[model samples]
Target: MVSENETIRRHEQDAFDSTHSQEERNEHGQFATPYDLARAMAEDLQSRVPSDSHVLEPSCGTGSFISALSALSDSFTITGVEKDSSLSETAQRLWANDSCNIVNADFFDYASSESEQFDAIISNPPYSRHHHLSQSEKRFYSQLAVSFSGVSLSGLAGLHAYFLLVGTGMLKTGGIGSWLIPSELFSVNYGEPIRKFLTQKVTLERIHFFDPENLQFDDALVTSCVTVIKREKPGDGARAVFTYGDFRSPRKTISIPLRELAALPKWQHLENYEERENHSGRVLGDYFKAKRGIATGGNSFFIKTRDEWHNEGIADEWLSPILPAPRSFHLSEVTSDASGWPQESDIALLNIPRTASYANLPTPVRKYLDGCPEKIRGSYILRHRSPWYSIGNTKSAPIVCTYMSRSDSTPFRFIRNKSDATITNAYLGLYPQTSMSEEELDSMCNMLNNIPSDVLINGGREYGGGLKKLEPRELMSLPLTSSPS
Candidate 1:
């Protein structure tokens, strides 16, 4: 009973999905674009280019963009470069028209050898995380940025950021380029190079950020934005349009000066309804220092519950009270026993002091450690330390906030740690600055806990799955609504 279009769509998805595992697709950051979005991008590109212009899709997947472009115009010769041979071949078969050309090649490699520039380069580049890349790959790309544009990119820059540079390199003089990229580039440290290139190198035309609550890709967790740039010199007083909501028809728009864009640390604020007036009032950073919670190289092996430690006959002296996972800790305040252990949480972190002699250790503790996995000893964090098991010195903070949250989930929990407890990377520890009192901190915690949802939305960056996360610096930069007296 399925319609022809429905049957065709189902077949296309089955063919694409059968070629690679989800892990492989994630490694390559390949998420198929929806037809509507691809069409929107094609229409935008078509509006700018001449009828006979040469257009390129650098990371075309299954030819969604190609089909859209073809539907828009038969005048332009559309060329697509896709890394996956199966998808490239599929695209060629589906769009068998002579106007379309699908090249099965790696975009980065192809871009390097390509001497001719295209009139328009439109793509949704791979969103692979930098951590997924090897050290050699990182070094090569880091150096590539410097050699290509004289801009030194952060080592943590993602695959999509590098694609922007490549797209820039492939752009003809005054040619247009548009990319559908994760919205994280607005504020993440790694996005600085791309932001610099956009402001200093290209004439940034418009940035359309889709609504965070209404995700574009059902399978992907990332919120996305469309970035439009032209390889033309920016003029004095030039400004870029910042649009929010749907990519095609935005709910709201703001015009930001190019100079302002260059100076601002976070572009998320541009989506705000109206800029807050300048104020010199003390911020969270003024009264407290925020640092991410401990990153134990191997959490499963290093972090254990009290039950597990007791079963192994480990002594309390060698362990530190650690907060339970953020989702498990519901209350805003944590009370402790006389031993300084969180009364409500049973989780404890395994700690080994550097000065302590393992030779003098209790037999039970030594035996337990001997049974530990060899992988833990070779872990990145442990391998670098003198003693493999030592977690280093971490003092309990007066307040802690979970670094990430789901939009519909409870607001980011700020816990008053009234115990000698440490937390994992899931939380950020907040220590009072010099001269700040515990009572003042208590008030600040309460105020921060009551932060308006709108404020949080504007301050934090949304990841895939509508998960909102804040870095220590971003959380600290947030302007306090009221001073804690």
Candidate 2:
């Protein structure tokens, strides 16, 4: 029987997290669900699953779901599978008195067993990115996913995709399936299989997106969504509910037809389907060309603070003034002195010449290069460059748009760059492709600074923890309020 003492159980979870290293937890993509959220999800699952239903939890960590289900009803038989031996042992001990069974076995292996099926599958699967898995691991997961869903999983998919597909496959006909997976599945290219399976194979019931500003899990940085589906294949005119904000009381809800899902490049924005196209046709690219700042393979090694450079006796000629990260440089307008250094910040970029022989370079320059560690010098990005240390195209632009910021409050800041100092990849440099006057440039920056938050957020990708990022191409496609050209 599961422990009735909720406080004591929560204390055990805290102890378990303290015992595990951050690196170890990250590699395993192990993050426990908060009890409140688990309870809410369990309540929702209760509505879909039949009485006396058997529930399956894949990648169960510390038995959040088990505890939630036990509180709801004692009749529902629950099975939790965890790959980690220690977590499974703890869960077994915690729920020893309960009717639930905890298994310490690889889920992929267990899921492949043809003999078992469940009335409901519910879990927050691992969010491990594909890059962490070895070639053999990727091949195994991909093959199993394809076998289960008949849709070829992309090599780039995270571990969450496999759980969704395999777990759904293990469901009884007309069984219910639900998952708390990364919102990336709604936006990234690799989510095709899950999206296809939901629309074409299973009936997508509803997808609830948590307000990014208020995350459900404490430490996990992933923006999450709760997706509910049924095992039955879709028929004509099937619709799925998309809700945003708090699950208890959603801020917005929209029902979209299943057939229309395949046409969308991404599904997260369905929460704002009504106002998604309220902007004008004219975009930033119509007047100015946006480009990402240069990549100095190793920013720390290639960029130096003003004090560090001056103390090293490196001549001003060997270094070019560069803007620091947006967080470090606060001014909306950058002005340079006669020496072309931004008066606000002292960071500078080194322009190590590849054409010149290393031996023939100035003593200070040679000393600086000698100080660089082997790892920085041999980094993949640097190794690919003709002269590993030389970062090219260090020219400054008139306008620099803040590349990323918090989604809820911080709108993208378009800084008027009145200086000759270049920017790093942290900011997008906007150059007037066509002729424009000084007044036009000023107006452009002002307009961008005042642009509605939705205009920028809809144009860019929202990363974990409410961070919205705009790449060069994504920024160019956004509608600009004013014409500066």
lDDT of 2 by residue, 351-379 (tens): 76667778888898888888889898888
Candidates' lDDT values, in order?
0.81, 0.83
Reference-based TM-score of each model: 0.88, 0.86
The best candidate by lDDT is 2
Best by TM-score: 1
In candidate 2 the C-alpha lDDT for residue 125 amounts to 93
Off by over 4 Å in 1: 1-10, 94-99, 131-150, 273-281, 297-315, 337-339, 373-384, 408-410
In candidate 1, position 159 carries an lDDT of 86
lDDT for position 456 in model 2: 74
Runs in model 2 lying further than 4 Å from the true structure? 1-12, 93-99, 259-261, 269-271, 285-290, 298-301, 304-316, 335-347, 373-386, 431-443, 481-485
- Number of backbone collisions per candidate, in order? 3, 2
State candidate 1's TM-score: 0.88
Check candidate 1 and list the clashing pairs: 221-464, 221-465, 222-464
